[model samples]
Target chain A: MIPASFDYVRATSLSHAIGLLQDDPDGNKLVAGGHTLIPTLKLRLASPALLIDISGIDELRGIEVADCIRIGALTTHAELLASKPLREVLPIFHQAADMIADPQVRNRGTIGGSLANADPAADWPAVVIALKGELELAGPTRRRRIAARDFFVDIMTTALEPGEVLVAIHMPRPNRGAKFRYRKIRHPASGYAVVGVAATLCLRDDIVSEVMIAITGATSRAFAADSASTHLIGKPLSTENIAMAASLTGEQAECLSDHYASADYRKHLVKTEVSRALASLNGA
Target chain B: MTDHTEELHVVTVDVNGVRRTASVEARKLLVHLLRDDLGLTGTHVGCDTSQCGACTVDIDGQAVKSCTVLAVMTSGSSITTIEGLARGGGALHPVQAAFHEHHALQCGFCTPGMIMSVRQMLGQNPNPTESEIRHGLAGNICRCTGYNNIVRAVQSLASEAPRHD
Candidate 1:
């Protein structure tokens, strides 16, 4: 499938890339790691007049821990899988990266690109939402920080404005007693989540101090499993509380009905995955 | 649509250790530029959508799906295709040799992508477990072989001399 004709510009730097977008009246699209955008372009779903290639900008590719563990927007999934710091500090992220599409896709796909694409079935959204990460955006005028909960507006949409690029993601290290888990029902072909859950619990003496549960794949955007989270917090690690929390899996998120899975099936997954994730926490 | 406002630009990148330049349509994909313009058909295009990993290539020491990358994006970078894997005098890379020796391939349509993927897998971790091999090759789908010998081929190649250099 040949893509439709469009202009191409390899941006030399971050400012140049943003400037390219700001100046273009006909609308230009940013291409970083192109796994998401290129496929859409090839399908003729999007035909922009200008494509600002930002993947060449080296400043946007890394993961380092400073005040917060910062993940550069252009950090490839393969890079994350290979990062020793990520493996040591946050092994769960590495696990999710391992489960992403395949080696080739991981080699080219970027975390920033994935977040910006905002695929509801994507794994990062659930993790990011559950972790309460911050997305730093470099827009034409200024840089701003958006919470993961606010960043995703809908399926395939984000809070990014025109001429804005997601620079990096910020994840502060989890506090002591933090227990985390990520579970997903993977689509056989794309390896995307049919329904995914990321659970983080801070347990103090067998009672939950803080709990965060994020649901993806069953909704237009990942969201807090508030009902489930509320049910588990301040409660003992028991079957009753776990069940109460697991039942809140997709209460808020609208389930999608498609040829792949019915809405009922996805709702069932929401319940089952939440329960399984909770069970793992209890076993641990 | 007659009055155009923008000018298409030309960019050059090193491919297979050879300096190749092409005056391409601004929207041309790197895979198309490699196969159509430069006539490097060894880099097959099974899925232009980037799902199949058939157009895998190494850009600046990293395996990337060529179909999703723009030719203009690779300017000033070195690219290695399946053609570049075998060096002077046609000495097969250990991975390529292992693939043949293990009969890892069947239809051979996905051979180039599969071979490239194995190189990436072994390059990152010299000794990957069988499960790691399966997970690594998941991006490069092969309807043939059921992936048994391909995993063996990668397992064998991982123990051999590094495919690079």
Candidate 2:
């Protein structure tokens, strides 16, 4: 379906994009990579009078690492998959990028766009929540950093205010001697996760020291599986503990019913995928 | 006129080594610009949604769903379509030749998207394993040929010719 008619404004710079949005009282929307928003617009799920295309903005399009790996909002999945730095230093980014929608979707979809859309089925949100990432948002007034945990409020909702644009995503340096793994049950058509789990653990002689687990696609928003993580922490990697943690995730997660799958099925998937994710971590 | 100049919306883009300039609505999809405005009909539109990659085109050296990209988004970018796959003198692209030689297409409904995707796959990884080829073409779905011949065509190109898409 064609999107409703709307005026398009080209933002030559970051400030120009902000200006366009600030001028619109009803609020102008930023279009970067338009992989998600465009579809939403087409379905009339969202209707913004003015669309400020920020894909042309040069500032938001690269991956840099100093104290942390900072990814520009416009960085495409295809670019992430081909990034030598990300592959060498943080392989999980590439692994997550590989599982996103199809190749065509990845080529045009942006990290910032997905984060801003906050689709529960999106894979990146799960990764960000697990890594304790920070989002750098630029608004007409000021810039603020929102924790990935707090950034996502619910499905199709975020902590973003009007006239604010997600500028970049900041991921802390991976802890040394840390083992990480993520697994997902992807929706066959859209490649969206039916259930996804991202787990990072600092293992000391096969016992969990620092464990962080984030669950996505099983609820309205990406959430930390605190109960599950607590179960794994200070415990040896064994089948018994893994089963206990997986069970805790089922109890802690707020599953939703949808046409694609039922709430019960999602719970079951959360249980199975968490177990599998833990197993992969142990094997690695 | 609201004191705002009616800025010239002229865009000159390089498509298939030929330059194209047209004044278009800001809301026009790139597929419309290429097919209706520039008369490049080889890029077919199967579904308006981005799900079907039938409207696939190479934009700025990357394969993207043309149906979702605005024409203005690609104002200065280079594009490659099915018509541009062959050489100026009628030499078919290696991937296209392989598809024809292997009978990879039946109804040809999804030929353009399949061909464009194959071009990108071979360009990215000239020699992809069988499983890699399957994953690579996972985005491009085909009802006919059952994907067996398509896989063979890509595999054949990967092994023997050493040609880039």
Candidate 3:
């Protein structure tokens, strides 16, 4: 379980991290929280020459609620759970944060690290994709923003380019009368989601003004259930319509099958979890 | 390939209210640094993959899996292991006393982590319900005792008036 030895350098600042990554052409990896990277390293699945510890970078820490909720990349899950502003403004983040692993793991797991790690079963992806969050990235040359929908490319893979570091996560303010929920069937041993669903609904005068349903742990990566969301929009929030929408989840995606659960079972779970999420929102 | 062992990083950490500095490899986990280097073996390493909470320790007042944290990453932070729970090495901490009184632990492999986790839980919510205690201890697993006495132990502590400090 011992990891491969590598050089460790704590980045003093955001730009310094990018500069170190640029200077080290021998696979320099940015580590935050080390919840995901350390395990991978111990497994010897990856052996980088240098590890850039961005956990110490003060600029990459804290939650700022302005026009949007700007969450620094190094903000831990414990911080997210404890944020009073997040709990009042966007309770869904707290809901998801509460279910992420347990207290010990959550104390060290970072939102940016989770998003960048892109674990198929990670809870943040479903919530971020459903909330339409944006990821801010900084590189040696310039900085750019990537939508959550496009940030996760595949399992444990993201659109982060070489020498690029994820700086923050930007989430638009939830619309008025917006109700959100995240429901998941977690694996008993690891606490990872066997199937997770996050739903955001904007209801106006009892009619669904907007809806977004993101499904995770059932496909290669977390993705918006377009068919489900489209079906629920402009329709009255009813059990029948919610059931219809829930059935549409994972319709277009290639559901994953493994020792944890079968593809058919996971697809079934997607429908069940989506229905439960929608039902909870409807009841709210 | 370079000889990675030749590269050692000096880390200064405050463990159990004591400041200690050590030279460790870049890949040295915090659990190994505490047990192997600082001689604080109370933090047991059950599952190094961060699944089991036997390696849990308080890092900067937060419970974290030490096996998943590199020693170099926690160089400047304060860490509290199971050894730090008692004052003046006299009596067990309140949580530890509760566990002992309730017979919460059968085999002691997971006791250090369980005690540390409960200490944190009680710190946050001095009076937690039975369900809350179960949820709080989800990260720490115990093969023996079946968690009945463990829940009772935490419940007994909660039944007492909330104690601050």
Candidate 4:
């Protein structure tokens, strides 16, 4: 399907993209990787007057590890899966990236684009929210940070303002004794998560010191299961405790229902997926 | 609904090691550019929607669905279609030879994409297990062969003498 014709300009720099978006009276869209925007354009879901191509912008293209792991917005899923630093530091990213679509899609999809697109079933939101990551946003004048938990406003919506661009994602270095896992029941056709759960656990002397559980695909937006995560704190990683925590996965969530899966089925999947992820962590 | 002829973009891309330049609408997909404009019809468009990997091609050393990528997005990228897999037009690439030997394709509609995907996979991992090959080929689907022989074709290449370019 051909998208509606639109003027395209390749941005020369980060500021250039922001300037182009700010100056366009008819509204402009930024495309990196074009995995999400191009599809939306083809379906006529979006028709911006101008497309600011930021895929070639050097400022949005690398993975750097300082105090926190900073991933450029344009980092592709394939690149994330292949990073030796990410594998050593945050293997949960690998678990999620490997489950995202296939190699061809991964080669062209960008983390920033995925997060900004904010698909309800996207894997990055669950993982990022579970890890308590932060996103850096740039605009025509200023820059600021938004926590992953606050980033997603609703399905296909984000906290980004007009003329703002997501520059990078910052994830804190994993705490010592940190163990994390992401589990999903993927749609057979699109490879999107039917019900995805990301769990991050910290154990001190066999007792849970810190725990965070985030669920996706079950709700309109991916969010941390606060009540369920709180239930794991100061408890041993026992089957009974895990079961109790998993049961609370969708207690506060407004689960989504569609032709693919019913709300009841998604809720059931939340429990099952959380239990499975916790079990994998327990076995590890 | 207004006329958008002004949105035409002049894209210069190196396809199969040869430079090809054309003026296309900014919304034209890479697959259409390769097949319609360049006349390199070896890259088939099974599904225009990026779901089927039939339009798989190597763009700057990565295998991507051409249907999902705009031709303007690859202004200076070096793309390799299935036609570029052979050397000197004489000997087939090991992947092609293996597919031919193992009868990997049945109807041959998905051959070009399958071959392109396998070449990229082998370029990354010269030796891959059966499970790895299956995972690598997940993007490319073939309804006829049931993937039994396709997996064998990739495995055969992995077991052969590593080809150095």
Candidate 5:
């Protein structure tokens, strides 16, 4: 399926790309790995008049596991899977990347594009939300960061403003004692998450100090399971508490239904996956 | 600063051992560029949507579905298709030889892509177990619905002394 005709420009730098989008944001779109954009174009879901290719911009690529974790928007899924330091600091990233499509897709798919695309079933949003990450956006005149929890607005939509390019993802390095896990039921064909649940729990003296439970692919958007997180905080990380926390995620939102899965089934999977993910973090 | 003026762009890719160039429209996919322009037809297009790995190729030492990439985007990268897998002396690439020895192909339509993906899979993990090889082959699908022999072929190559090729 050949995509619709469009002019393409390889942007030289971050500012150059944002400036290009500023000219005609509606008619122009940014292309990093083109894993999602190309498919969207081929499906004729979008036919931008211009594509500002940011793949060559060297500044937007890397995984830095410093005091604060900073991931350049253009870092590929393969890069994430290969980063020994990133795996050591936040192995949840490796878990998420491992469950993504196949090796070939991972080689070309960028985490920035995945998050910016905001596919409800995309694993990055849930993981980022659980990790308490922030997204850095660059526009023609200014730059700002938005929390991942609030960045995703709806299906295939994000808080990204017109002419603003997602430049990087930021997260405070997780607490040394925090437990991280991402568990998902992958759709057999697409390898997309049927329902993905990510858990990041920090235990202090056997009580939850910080906890986040985020669910994806079950609702109109990836969302933090706030009720579940609230239930887990200030509580022991027991199997019973985990099960109760997971149960709250089922009714957290009215799940969306498609030919692949019904609303009830997805809701059920959300609760099940949340329980499974959180329970895994209880002891180890 | 990028030139947003032109509709046609020039791309140069080193395919196999040869550097090939083409001036193509921005919408032209890399698969079309290879199959239509350079005539490296071994990279099949089983599904153009990037799901099916029939169009798999090595781009900068990574397996990528050509259908998903714009030809113009890979301006100076090195790409290798099944046609490029053989050694300089025309001996079959170990992957191809393995497949041949294992009788891995049923219909042979997905053979090229499978071989290419396996090459990259092994490159990343020189010694992969059966489960690992199966995991790595998640991108390629045999319409014939058989992967036993293909897995065996990869197992044979993986168990051999790691080759630099």
Candidate 6:
């Protein structure tokens, strides 16, 4: 598939990218991995006048593993899956990365592109939401941070302002005693999640101290199952309670339907995968 | 070499141990650059939608789907195609030999891309189990239903000396 002709400029630095976007926010689209944007362009779904290539920026790469985890927006899925420090600190990342497209796609598709694109089936939003990540945005004038919970608006929509670019994601490492899990039913052809659920639970003295659950691929946008999560807090960590919470997932959101899966089936997946994810951590 | 209405980009790359440069349009795909401009047609394009791995090639050290990659974005990178797999003496790559010995192909249309992906999997993990091999080859589709032999071919290499990718 061939894309329409468009002007391309490689952004030399983060500020350069911000400046380019600020100059032509509506006409230019920033490309890091180009895995998502190039396909959309090839299909003529989007035809911007210019493309600012942010893949070459040195500042938008690497993972910092300290008390607070910092991940560059351009960090590829392979990098996340391969980082021993990241895995040791947060296993949810590699778990989600492992289920993301194939090895070749992972080698090229960046986390920033995946999140910014806001593809319904993309895995990072739910993972970030469950882990309570803080997305850092850089604009021409200033920098701001937004919680992952408030970042996503809808499919292909984000809270990012015009002329702003997502630069990094910062989040405190989950407590050492906490357990995290991400589970998904993979679509055979596309490798996207039919329905995916990411959950984090901290159990102390046989009681749930903290819990977060986010469901993706089962709604217009990824959403935190706040009711379900709240139901589990201060309760006994039991399979029955887990199942009850899983049943509450996607209770408010309307799911999207396509040739691959129906909305009803996706709803079924939310409950199934959530229960499975929570059950996986039941013994731990 | 020629530009008309669209803006052109100057891209340079090392392919099959040779450094080559080409001026292409901003929309040109890496697969076309290799086949049309650089004359390395061994890298096939089966599914242009990026689902199939026919256009798989080694970019730097990663096996990437060339159809999904823009030529201009890959400037200054090293790319290796199926044509580069043969040794200096024209000997087939060990994976290719295994495929040939095991009759791992039917129509052979997916052979080059499949081999490239297999080389990548083996490069990452010298000895992968049956399920891992299957999972690793999930992205590359062989329509001839020759997956059994292909799996066996990959399995046969596990007993040999570790291949340095």
Number of the candidate with higher lDDT, 3 or 4:
4
Ten contiguous residues minimizing lDDT sum, candidate 2 chain A: A1-10
Q: How much lDDT does each candidate structure score?
A: 0.83, 0.86, 0.89, 0.90, 0.89, 0.89
- Tens-digit lDDT string for candidate 1 (B112-160): 9888888877777888887777777777878889989988788776665
Please write out the lDDT profile of model 2 over residues B52-152, one tens digit for every residue. Answer: 78899998778888988888778889999999988575988888899999999999978898889988888888888778888888777788889999988
> For residues A1-284, could you state the per-residue lDDT of candidate 1 as single tens digits?
66677777779999999999888634688888888887887888888877888877887878996557899999988888889977776666887887888777787889998998999999999888888899999988899999998999998989998888899999988876677888999998778999998988887888888988898899888888888887887889788777767666656657998899999899989988998887887747
TM-score of 4: 0.97
Local accuracy of candidate 5 as per-residue lDDT tens digits, B1-165 = 233344678898898889888999999999999999998898999978788899999998999999999999999999888888784659898999999999999889899999989998888788887788888999998978489999889988875653432
Provide the lDDT at A240 for model 5: 89
What is candidate 1's DockQ? 0.54
Scored against the native two-chain complex, candidate 4 gets a DockQ of 0.68
Error of 5 at B87 (Å): 5.8
Q: What range of 10 consecutive residues in model 2 chain B has the weakest lDDT sum?
A: B1-10
TM-score of chain B taken alone, candidate 3: 0.92
Residue B110 miss distance in model 3 (angstroms): 0.5
Worst 10 residues of 1 chain A by lDDT: A244-253
List candidate 4 segments past 4 Å from native: A24-26, B1-3, B160-165
Candidate 6's residue-wise lDDT over B7-101, tens digit each? 78899999989999899999999999999999889899998877888899999999989999999999999999999999475989999999999
Tally clashes: model 6.
Answer: 0
Quality of model 4 by C-alpha lDDT: 0.90
Q: Mind giving the per-residue lDDT tens digits that candidate 5 earns over A199-218?
A: 99888998999999888899
| Native A-B interface contacts kept, per candidate | 0.71, 0.46, 0.76, 0.75, 0.84, 0.60
lDDT of 3 by residue, A182-245 (tens): 9899898878899999999999888999999898888889999999888888999899998899
lDDT of 6 by residue, A1-284 (tens): 78878888999999988988888788789998889998888998888888899998888888999989999999999999889999999999988998888888888999999888888888999999999999999988889999998999988899999999999999898887889999998888787877889999999887999999998888878889999988999999788897888777756547779998898888878888888888889875
